[model samples]
Target chain A: MTSDRFDLGGGEPIITLRDIAKSYWRETLEIPVLQGIDLEIPAGAYIALMGPSGSGKTTLLNLIAGIDRPTGGSLEVCGHELNGLDDDQLASWRNLHVGFIFQNYNLVPVLNAFENVELPLLITGASRGERRDRVEQALALVNLEDKMKNYPRQLSGGQEQRVAIARAIVTDPDLLVADEPTGALDAKNAEEVLGLMERLNAEFGKTIVMVTHDPKAAHHAKHQIHLEKGVLDKAVEVNR
Target chain B: MRWLALIWKSLMRSKRRTLLIVGSLVLSVFTVAVLQSLLTTLNAVTNNPNSSNRLVVRHKSGLTQMLPRSYEAYLRQQPEIETVCALQWFGGYYQDPRNFFANFASDETTLFQIFREEFGASGISEAQIKEYLRDGAGCIVGESLARKNGWKVGDVVPLTGTIFPINPRLTIRLIFKSPKPSDENALHFHYKVLEEGVPYMKGLSGSFWVRAHRPEDIPRLIERVDRHYANSAYETLTETENAFNLAFVKMLGNIGAIIQGITAAVVVAILIVTGNTMATAIRERTTEIAVFRAMGFSAGRVLVLLLSEGVLLVGVGGFLGVLLVNLAAGGVRSSLGMAMPFFADFAILPDTILACLAGALAIGLLATFVPAYAATRRPITEGLKAVG
Candidate 1:
């Protein structure tokens, strides 16, 4: 077996992990969430992570999204070592390279769909015309061009999640991490959202890493990795 | 643009709360603007250079202490003093005690000479002045007092004296047309009329009103006049018209400071209320702020958006208050009459507006710090997890 500190190349692997460990402190006791995780995600590869409730799936997703730091291992995403980065640097990196989607579809209620999609583009020093163009393209991609001016209160649950997705991908980040993107939706709406994510991965050659408890959602991805009790158990390849 | 949209949305979130805060601000600012305007007008009237040309010389002991009639003759001899008149304060009341006015008894021969600008032949003929001076019991009432008492030019009205302990017997001889708009509330009568009726007035006089060639020469001329009688039995106090008016106002003690303190308290209270409102709004929009941060907005931009909204709200309120004050200025002056100066200076409104804007912005920035920081520091995963 290879050592956990495997490095793919000098600059190719978009994400690299070496014996990453994470824990939650509850009073004096240390409750370990993730233990000894080693991972490598290449550029433009779709990855699906599947696990049960206590499998540290969310914690791993948090680490990959740059929302939390690993405890005992090195994590490198987009050729930047996240272990040594401060909170500000991590936030900047996340803005530049990482996009996040959650089950609840956290959207600003005050802004219309178009403005919401344009939010991430504001921090990138993009010109106003470029921002507008990208926002239009994103809204069009989700087939929400007609509802661009509608506020979140005027949209349905599925449409809101689609808007959130548009906001995430508008900046064209290197990695799109979604934690249960369809958890709040009904079967039909869930299928529609999943279809959109699958199309984005296939048509744009975008890399997507999704954590889900649904087997059907995992079937849509090219590679699926299962975690059980803070450890990777198996990897499966699926033909879409 | 993004920040503006965010602020707009946040304000729109609760229409009732926004309206309440803005409404209260408008009312409070309006009241303050009106009060400040009146105070400014009164202060200007008393401090104006034109208003200081006149002077009042009374007994050194007190205004009630009478001066010798010879003092007036002595003052008239000074070349620096152009004219001198004996003015006796006749403490009297109209039919109703509330209908108060200034009634003064002055030497008829020199009264018109000293107040030539206030009454001229166009309003009161020189023949009538001669006739009033010849008649020892003759009196001239101001137009405002005449109007208030409904006394015509030839009408005779009785006045009761409170200080001289005389029988309730006096009459209005003629009504002098008011020269300036502000001088319509005075009553002037011949001091010789009082001297003839009161038994104790053989050598007693009230005070002297002096007119000087140049306002600047008043102090030196007054020193010369006072030095002439320094060792005499009756010592005198000489003061400019403005100083005399200010001394009377000062008797009330620090009215300006009291008004300033009240104004300061109001401003502080407004800041606290506005700050609390902004804080609550920011807290309610915490998740939305995080969403903006996730979308690439900096914390500074968020703060600017919130602060701009606050300034806008205060600007609107302040403007409304100024408009109201300007509209009511005329009515305020007419109603206050001579008690207070009517229209105050409108120049101060701009500074007040700027102050309100700064105050609003300060509250907004202070309120925004915590929420903006919280949003900036929020984990993208956790923020996305928030349901609302």
Candidate 2:
């Protein structure tokens, strides 16, 4: 439960966006997904993004994670301007500083829990011993140390989500970006993943940004921001 | 290095698909290896590196027509021609048609002198050569031919003739070894047995073999020997031993073109099968590919991993297939001898094996290129929406 990792320092903006806009093309017509998204999230802050479908909450999450680039505005995550980085540089930036958790668990079907969690570390060129130690530590954090050898197909929905969470946090990323992390899980499993993610933010002082439709899932974060049709709603602070 | 494990695991995700692709690749490469090695073995017949100093004088029209045995007398008078021997093809069978091999009727006294480099320089003793000439009915058999049948030295070999109307039962006077395997599958008997037994072959031969004093003098001697009989009743066609062997291969029809066509078809088949397999595998893993990209694995890295999977699959399969061909060399040689008498030992050459492996790897790389690139270039947000 204790994080003896590098301190990202207090009150510094981990993610900064200025009038960010993302648009795509449907053949000849221009379709806009996100528009004028100006926001700042402080270091070590836990936030949830809430919106209906096509509200561009996941798009904004992707922009912040450096998985997608803004077409019209400045995006800075963990001190690097994501819009200015090339595809390869954006990948390295994401690998080093941004962690991701998906609704489908996204654990490589062939890899067991330990190997899946060790993926981002491999991108950092970490030695095998270092990777093993870090993987063990991360699995233990998620309470899945006993299931480290189980593949995704062999695990339950809850165990798979927890393993995905372990994978997202194993690299000690500066920002954890999760899109509906517990969307596929049952009620009990959803509560457990939310609790683990909350503990990661509160006890380890890790920064997290999650997108969810469930109000209960949003409440686990310290702050909740809503989007309506590519526009932001007022941010709400939650007293947990 | 770390991605190796990932690549391997990804390939094994659908074991049946991977195995099918590998099986197809192995079979294709094995066929290609066999065909190319057969071509190589045939070429090895004409490319006798040790017999460059020898020349053969045959009928100008083709090997079917006979040359005058008097040509051997004229060829022996030349200073450049160290020794000359008349050789006639004795197409015959042993106990069964399946036991077919090369049996030549040649000058018993001078055959040893003309083929001194192939025999005398090896380990054939003076006594064996003298004994072969001492008996007109004696024949010198190649060691392999003798070993294949139970025809040891002093054993009488009864041959049923097919080309000439004479059944010559001759004693095995010597069993000589040659540096070349093709040369070790022939038997040579005294020319007198062939001449006296047949009416038309009294003063005719299939060809006149002349060993030059030096290899460098062969070109001039070839010109001299041909010009000597430029306008005779049966004109002479003189050439090096390599050309003579190549003429026989050429008569067997377009083997080179056939081999090339077969290899080309094999390459195409492998590419199509492997490409389809890779495309399907990548299509099944769209979301996983996006996940890797989102985890900071670059597009290039994704392609490299996928390409490695394909290449390694074919590489491993192709190598095993080639190894199987190598193991079946003995059987292939025995089977091919009935149709292609020049197949020698029928084993795959080192260069041909390397080519098959390289070809398999090339197929692997090409087969996955489009699929891997397409997967890596898929939009991340769109890809994340994929169900599985």
Which structure among the candidates has the greatest DockQ? 2
Task: Evaluate model 2: give its lDDT.
Answer: 0.87
Interface DockQ of each model: 0.33, 0.65
Clashing pairs in 2: none
In model 2, how large is the Cα lDDT of residue B297? Answer: 92
lDDT (10s digit) by residue, model 1, range A1-240: 212333222326688788989988889999998898888877777778888988998889888877778888999988799888876676678888888777878787777898888878877888989999999999899999999999999999899999999989999888898989998988888898999998888888677889998998888777787788998766666765
lDDT of 2 at A216: 92
Q: Please state the interface RMSD for every predicted structure, separated by commas.
A: 2.7, 1.5
TM-score of 2: 0.94
Tens digits of lDDT, candidate 2, B225-285: 7898889889989999999989888887898999999999989988999999999999888
Which DockQ value does candidate 1 get?
Answer: 0.33
Quality class of the docking in candidate 2, CAPRI style: medium
Fnat of each prediction, in sequence: 0.38, 0.87
What TM-score do all the candidates reach, one by one? Answer: 0.76, 0.94
